[model samples]
Target: MEEMECGIEKKAAAMAAAEEVGRKEEAAAGDVGLKELSRKLNDFAKARDWEQYHSPRNLLLAMIAEVGELSELFMWKGEVRKGLADWDEAEKEHLGEELADVLLYLVRLSDICGVDLGDAATRKIVKNAAKYPAPSKEGA
Candidate 1:
């Protein structure tokens, strides 16, 4: 009985660790601001002497390629809303990898161009909000 209890405890601990990993992966993409992400990407590229290959044009092309790859995952699949969970594990993993590639290239490009992506995104959001205000009850 004691051995069985120990086995169950081990299983519970393993399950908890798995859950934590899943949560971390779920929150991996959007949590970091562009400034921090760009700094990390810049350091990574510098460490590898990859800065030479990271000109804005090259980075932009790489980013566009990744975006195309990501889009291909949903190609001909009509109306992708709320159906991501229906995808197989390999499909989902590929999607995430392509997304990461796009983001890394974009950050590298922004760093090379000295663009403050976070501030630019914030300003664009404000501009968009002013251009498309919420509909009031009177409009309804």
Candidate 2:
């Protein structure tokens, strides 16, 4: 079953990669939402038959690893802004790749767990706004 799943995932990923070439046009035109990206990633995995390895735990670990790589880019840099500003094109590209990896794993994990990330994010934002309200005119 595991082998079968891996095969499926590989096929899915290949198909997704091919489709990604075409998707570049859409991506260039406008931003894609988390749900859209999630669907694309799920389709990618389904095609390759790799869902057997997309358990939440594994995905979480993969996300953590990607974060670690992203963090490494900032190591020795005093501040995030300075680090980003100082990076050349290659470094920035590397940073972007790591970030993309983290997002991909996160989206995959959320999809498998049946979480609606957009709704969850909206609720969190509303909760945060209530938790930290703007200062009143009198206070200011």
Candidate 3:
């Protein structure tokens, strides 16, 4: 009985450690922001001499194309749930890639246009909240 208790305790400890590591990884991933992604995109373009081709119009067009690709993935899928519960790994990965492509182009476009995308987005969110306030509990 003592040995069984020790084995269970070891399993619980291992599970707890795994959960802690997963949390730490999630926190680290959350640290990556638009600025870092923008910088990486800029460096990638510069290294390949593609910066000249990344004009605002060109980036915008590329982003739109990526959006089309992303939309195509859901075109026939009739309303997917929030968690994409039915998506296979390959489908989800493809969706992620298309989304990332759109974001990268948008970040690059914003950089070329001298716009701080993060700050602009933050201000837009504030404006939207002010423009469209939530209903009060009293009203409900």
lDDT of 2 by residue, 1-140 (tens): 99999999999999999899878855663577898889889899899998899899999998999999989988887767755777799989998789889888888888888999889889999999999998789965
Candidate 1, residues 50-137, lDDT tens digits: the string is: 9889877888998999899988988998887685867888988888888888888887888799888888888999999999997889
- lDDT by residue (1-140, candidate 3, tens digit) is 99999999999999999999989867886587999988878899999999889888999999999999999999999999998999999999999889888888999899999999999999999999999998889966
Q: How many backbone clashes does candidate 2 have?
A: 11
In candidate 3, which residue pairs get closer than 3 Å at backbone N, Cα or C atoms, i.e. clash?
none
Report the CA-based lDDT of candidate 1 relative to the real structure: 0.86
Q: Which 10-residue window of candidate 2 scores lowest in summed lDDT? A: 24-33
With candidate 2 superimposed using the best TM-score fit, by how many Å does residue 22's alpha carbon deviate from the native?
5.0
2 against 3, candidate with superior lDDT: 3
Query: For each predicted model, how many residue pairs clash, with residues at least 3 apart or on different chains?
Result: 0, 11, 0
